[model samples]
Target: MILKLVSYAGNLFGFLFLTLSIASGLYYISELVEEYSEPTKRFLTRAIYGVIGLLVSLLIFDKFPFKLTVFAIASHVLYLQNMKGFPFVSFTNPTFLLSCACTVLNHYLWFKYFNDVEIPPQFKFNPNYIPKKRATFSEVASFFAICVWFIPFSLFVSLSAGDYVLPTAEELKKTDDPTAQPKLRKRTINLVRVAINNVRGFIRSSLRIFGFKIAEPEYDRLSI
Candidate 1:
């Protein structure tokens, strides 16, 4: 009973982490659409190409599922549709909405694949010959980090709403400190800096847990 309870709790925590990551990813993409327009479009286009390349390689050399390849390719095409109007597209555009849905589908499929979770018993039609292949944990984690979660994490590091309103040259000369950052820019920088430090600290701690003697570096600034 205790082991079962622990397993259940672990699964719950994993589920929460996965859900939050997906939410953060979608939020990041939406914000990119709002702010970075052209650059974001280019990035997504390249990302889709990369994903297609990976899918093709997998098809040739790995036992990856066919349905997932189709889903991923379709999702990228849907995402490209959002770039058609160059940032003028509505959030409610049908293609974009469908892309979000496909994003969730991809997440679900990859999560299950990486975690080695079996299909639920009710859904197991062919009990004797179920496909059991799964990606290694490292592969899945790296994929999520680069392909799925990079935007959200980078947005946390780069977005500066307050710095949007720049001071004029005359206003800059009036300031006592010429080097002083705008309030919003300073705040955003601090937030990103602290976040990066905190992530470093967490990685250090986790490494220590695994018997790796990583030195914890002291930050000059406050960390989260």
Candidate 2:
């Protein structure tokens, strides 16, 4: 019962992790599209080339299982198609739909491969002679993290949302009601600056949680 409960919990956690990772990856892509559409496109183009090259090399070497190799090749091809008009497309676009299909197919194929039984062809009469093939939780998790699921997550991150744009300071200033624009006013710091400060704050907070006392950095004031 305990082992079963643990297995169930682990599966739940893994599902949640994948869901959160995909969501964050999408959000990161959305933000990139809002801020750096051109750069994002260039990066995705470069990535697709790398992926294609890698897939070709893998096919030539045939290091992975035949089924997985075929899936990888197909996934890369779909990824290449996704690079077309990348930063601009409705969710209903054929390329987007195909990419989504490829992502799920690739993930399922990998999962199936990982769970595959390696029974010998000659051991049909003796079932007990066949060796058990079991993957540990860590091995399965790492495989998904580094290989199977990562490609789709990366594709999600590389995609740009052409419809979304950061509001300009001029646009923010155009509001007649001052109280209504309080949030805009509060955003005085640039996104980059806020990100850096947030990172610093997180690091400090983490150190504090670990019982480590860290002195805050002091900036020099100009004496004119």
Candidate 3:
């Protein structure tokens, strides 16, 4: 069901997801810059625990989409751990790669939007490890240039190569019995109906669930 939506171009939906991801990413990044190099383990650990519990529920429920969502969060945690030492600026710093990292962080923030996390301050820096200064407007403009150029460029290349993947949903079952066909049709309809309602419910819930919560005490401990 989740994959079905993703199977298509998903332009608006993808952009919405990206917006959520970017907003979350930027906020988390801002918090990190303001105080900590990383989030406090308490909040992070809670997120880990929540993900674990979600995984357990997925196992019990045998829900693939549920599992994928949890795995996505777990993916970010692993990603963060791997890139923790990476400096924001480098001669060889791959912008796309960094963008991907930023995307993951954004995804995590979206996943945990309602929750509070403690960002720990970065107090330790090697004497020789000179951090890059904040990105200026020109620097920001230059970075956007890469994004503007790359996405369209890739689209063009894909068109030139005639390489675009069209996605389709996994077939649920094969049918034979005439009576069973109606039953299957009915079931599919019911599933679609249920999914729609769930989505509607989520929208309503999301509307009410606004605001970013940072763990105040943990935020205070950011400075070493």
Q: Each prediction's TM-score against the native?
A: 0.45, 0.51, 0.23
Scored by TM-score, the top model is: 2
RMSD of 3: 24.5
List where candidate 3 sits over 4 angstroms from the true fold: 1-33, 38-42, 65-74, 83-224
Quick one: RMSD of model 2? 12.1
Residue pairs clashing in model 3 are 36-120, 36-121, 121-222
lDDT of 2 by residue, 69-118 (tens): 77677777777777676544446788788878877888888788777786
Per-residue accuracy of model 1 over 3-118 as CA lDDT, tens digit each = 99999999999998997687566445454545564586576567667766776677677766688766766666666665565434334568756766777777787677667767
Q: Please report the candidate that would top lDDT against the real structure.
A: 2
Task: For candidate 1, report its TM-score.
Answer: 0.45
Q: What is the lDDT of residue 190 in candidate 2?
A: 23
Clashing pairs in 2: none
Sliding window of 10 residues with minimal summed lDDT for model 3: 154-163
All candidates in order of TM-score, best leading: 2, 1, 3
| Stretches of model 1 off by over 4 angstroms after superposition | 1-40, 117-134, 147-224
Output the lDDT of residue 187, model 1. Answer: 19
Tell me the deviation in Å of residue 104 in model 2: 0.7
Per-residue CA lDDT of candidate 3, range 96-205, in tens?
Answer: 35545555554454345323243324624445544444445675455334322232222111111111233223332444443643222211012222333355456656
Range of the 10 consecutive residues with the lowest summed lDDT in candidate 1: 184-193
After TM-score superposition, what is the CA distance of residue 9 in candidate 2 from its true location, in Å?
15
